[model samples]
Structure formats: C-alpha cells, structure tokens
Target: MTSSPEPTYTWGTTSEINSFIRHLNKSHRILALCGAGLSAPSGIPTFKGSGSYWKNHKAAALSHPETFEANPGLVWSYFAERRRLALCAEPNKAPRALAQVARKRKGFVCLTQNVDGLSQRAGHPKERLFELHGSLMDIKCSNKECDYIDKENFAEPICPALAGDPEQPSSFSFSAKRTFTTQRRDATLSTKPSRTNAHEEYKYKREPNPLEALLESLSPTITPEMRQVVIPESELPHCPKCDSLLRPGVVWFGEALSKPMFDEINAWIEKEKKLDLMLVIGTMAEVYPAARFVHLAKEKGARVAIINLDAEHTGGIGLGKNDWMFGGDVEEVLEVLFEGVLLNG
Candidate 1:
C-alpha cells in the first residue's frame, strides 16, 4: 500500500470516490466488518483504547479472565458501568442506515466486534448479524457442565452487589497548561482546597493521566474510597443450576470465538464464487480471522473500501491502490456511501 497521500490531495477523496460509490450501489453481495468506532457517536467509551480507564484500572487488566477469577466483584462492577452506558445509548445513523439497506439487500452480512447491541436496536436483521465479541447483556455459568446461558438479559446491575453503583467518570482526558479558577463550578468546598478562602478564586493544575484524573471525574458520584472495591464471594453473581460463578459473555483476552460463528462464515464464503464488495467499517482489520476476511474478499475479485477516521490508515492491512478509503466519521461516511442503496423507492 502507498504509505502517504500526496500533499496536493488531502486524504485522497478524488472524483474516483463517486465511481466507487456507484459501484457499491450496484453490488449484490456485501460484507461490513464493524468495530467500536461504530458506536462511539452514541456516547460510549471504546474498551480497547487509552480512554478505557475504568475506576483507575486499565481496561485490559479488568477484561481478562485472570482478573475476573481473582475478583469477580470488581470485574462485575466494570461491566455494570459499561452496560448502563450501553443501554442509555441510542443507535446512531450508521447503524440505522445499515439496517435499512440490509432489509432490502439479500446478500449482506455484518460481522461486528462490538458488544453494545446497537445494531439490533437499529432493527438490523438478526440472521444477517454476527457478534464476534459476545454481548455484555449476556450472562453465563463458568462450569462447562451447566452451560447455563441467559441471552439479552437487560436486568439492571445483574445482581444486588452491583446495584446503585456510581456512574462512570468523564470519558476523556484533557491537558491544562496552567491552573484555573471558577467560582461558578463547584459551590461546595468539596473540590476547593481547604487552605483557600471560599470567597477567593482557587487555581489548581491537575495533570490527569489515570490516577490523577480519578478524583475529579469520580468524586461527588464515586468517592475516592471506593476505588478498590472488591465484592465478597457471596455477593458476586452465581449460576442458578450448578451454583458456579456467573461471568459476562464477552470474549476475554485469551479466548477464541465460538465454532458456530466460524461455520456460518464458512458457509457464507462457500456460497459465493465472488464477493462483490467488502466494506471495512470503523475497524482496523488488524485482528485475525476477521482481518483475513478482507484479504479473502479482495482475492475473490471484491472491491474493498475502508470507512474510518484515519486517511493514512495502513492498519486496515489489505488496502491497496485499487481499494477505496473514505476517511471520516463513520456515520457521515456511511450516510453518503449508502445514499442510493438505502432508498426504499
């Protein structure tokens, strides 16, 4: 792949993009590989990125099977917060557009790495969608014998221990060069230094990474004392039949996707002699198996297009001169990309 776009052309959005859109409209079989970026517009924090510091612990730390085994309470709490936010989020335009198109299109499949279920909320057909990472809304038993599973269990908090837990802090990190004071922000003396007079303005320079930002974002909702909360064994959610511990259904760090999903994908590939179009939407096709689909599609005479935020995104892996890269907010890109195809008339 060419490393960089020419200086004369900013992100390589030439008239050729129109030709690509025209081709997409005519295509019969299409595949969209989606990721966390698809749901970011709905005020949800991505689990894989730097912004995923849940209560001062790295997302990678809390999402691992090892962490869940040691402290189920703490792990459950992290998911509870994520679930709360996910339920509150409305499906954005990108999902709605995809759903509308999938309704009319016969050979479209969406394989998503997101667990938020936003696409389902947008009325995407169940048979056409595959969730690569298991949903947060599911709960399952740890014991393989029991194999107890509850799907779409939207019950708040999942258990009593997680009930009434404080909300997640701000999802962003800001940089401040110098201290600033505002009389209007915090009326109470809680945030203000005790040494400063109430009537006077107080300026404190806070360099927030993970730990430092914890106070400002959590305080008033989640107190500093609650940072290292660990639920008792009895309080953590357990299975009803086998009496084993219950766990979130998401794919952890050292887990493989279920075999049935692979079978479904295999059938899809075998059914088509040639895939007409492949859209890598909101995902860096860097991850395995899923990423390989992009290469396979291109190999089978499919026109590849990437819809993401970065123009020079080589991470999509299989992109080349013949492929198209529409760089922008995914919602905006999808809205334009599917304009003619989404029309019911």
Candidate 2:
C-alpha cells in the first residue's frame, strides 16, 4: 500500500512555517534560482505569455541573431524599449527581501535567470550571486574583430538614434514596404490558421536558409500593422574601437554562456562541496543546463524549495518528502522565509 504524500507547506500554517524556519537556520549552504516571476510584482512583464507584441513582432523574434543581422535598427528599437522598461521598474520589495537572507547566510548563493539587474539593485552580494542570463543594461560590439564591451550601464536611450518614444511612427525602406505589402495582398490569411504564421509553423519542417527569413518577415501572416524603424544602420550605436554595430550584452537563443562566469560558479559549488537548500523562485528550472545545475545541487543533498505564484501548477511535481513548496506571492513567501523566522545565519 502507498504510505502517504510528503507534506507541502504553503505560506500559511504556523507549524509548517516554523519547521521551514528551523531548516533555513540550520542550513549551511543555500542556493536560490530566480526567474521572471520574481520581478512580476515590480511591474516588469514576463513577455512570454500570448499576445506580447511590439510593432507586430514577438519579443523572441526581435531578440534573435537572424533578425538583428537583417534589421539592426528594428531589433535595437525593441531592445531599447525593453531596457527602458527594465530601468524604470523598481526592484520589488521581495527583491531586497532575498538580499537580506543572502547577506545573513554567507554560503547562500542566488542564481538568477533574469537579465533586468534587479538583484544587484536589491543589494545581493556580487560574489554570492550568479546571473545565468546576463543583464540587458550591458552593451557589446557585434563586430567579430571588435573587442568592445560595457557592463552595468544605466544610461538612457543608449544611443542617439534609438532616442524618443519607441511607439512613434516608424519608417521602413520603400523596397521593404513594397515587398511586405505585396506579400500581404498575395497571401490568403483566411485559408491558414494558427497563432504563428505559415513560415513559423513549418520552420522545423523546411531546411534552414537566409532567404526563408526574409520571405517570412515579408509574409502576409505578419500583423497587418507591423512597422519597421527608419533609423539608418550608420546611426545605431557603434563600437568605439572599430565603429561596429553594438548589441545588447544579454544572451540570445543558440548562444553559449560565458565560460569564465560558469567557471566561477563551478568553483563556488566545488568549494562549498555540499548544498543544504536550493530556493527555486519565480521560475521552474525545467530547461537543461539550468536544470542540470539544480540537479547537481540536489544530488549534493540540497532540499528543493519552490516559491511561485501558481499554487496549483506547483503542488505535485513529485517533490521529495524533505523538500518544501511555498505557494503564494513572492513578497509574502519571502516575508515568511526571512522576517520573523531568523535574522542571522
């Protein structure tokens, strides 16, 4: 016969809360993996949900290497707005909330997937923090020969050309406009169905080619109102060393993470030798590499603690009896975890 399910402690229930408090106080090594959900209360949109569009382009589409190579101005426009939004968003109260615990627990490490720089603003110790995804605030040269890179730059409008409201009337070359309009008129939208365009639907089915991307963007499936920026390539941010095009420092799809940074993180893990706790916050570490890290920590004896907004979805992920799941707002969960629980490590 099955024995019983492991106890899942939510924000409520005094007994469970106290037990977690004891766990936090006794743990020697703790790691927290943060995600986009952590910044939700801070007014930063995840941009992963349906209908997240900018000038008829999805956030992911504009962030790709192919898109940037084809239309640097358009890609820059999207990222510029995102950077502005990130800067404008204040670190959530829960943000500083984690900072307090990290400060108290010397062995505690925070591994955040967000590139918004909120963790830094919240005052988490740099040595103890691991940014799996780099920050949007940083800048780097796109030219292969150029070695230009800048970190933690909060300056607005990064460049003069991307300045002004991003929602203003956009400009596209006559040829591009003509191609887009001609495609729209030629295709029959009513005949096709799906949130994605025909090209997107069959991307994996077809062989890879640069010509396909160009044709897809000009496809009728693109939002009828999609607009492209007019800023010439010459005016975009350029590398001081080679005057080459500049790109966001954040990692894009199909890009490898910084090896040096990973080395530092690996060193930290090896030095610690074992983990007592791993706070899974905001994000579900389901993807590989990131998931691999969490798996390693668990193998090293870390108990998983998930703190997220979705209670129903998180309830039954087959957590071991030793693990804890805190289902509720991040701020509330953090309050329960730190405040009134334990002040010092």
For candidate 1, the clash count comes to: 0
Task: Report each candidate's C-alpha RMSD, comma-separated, in the order given.
Answer: 12.7, 12.4
Task: Score each candidate by Cα lDDT.
Answer: 0.70, 0.68
Candidate 2 clashes: the total is 0
User: Which ranges in model 2 have alpha carbons more than 4 Å from their true place?
Assistant: 1-12, 166-229, 314-318, 340-345
- Model 2 alpha-carbon miss at residue 189, Å: 43
Model 2, span 1-345: residue lDDT tens: 999853333333555566777888888888788876688677565544332456556655666676777778877887887787688878986778888777877888888888989999999998888788788989999986787899899999788887866576433223322332232233323344332333232211111222233243342242323335457888999888888899998877656777888888777777766888878887666654666667778878888888765433442234788777665567767876787534544
Kindly report the root-mean-square deviation of model 2 from the true structure over all alpha carbons: 12.4
Off by over 4 Å in 1: 1-14, 166-229
lDDT of 1 by residue, 99-151 (tens): 88889897889889889989988999999999888898899997768879999
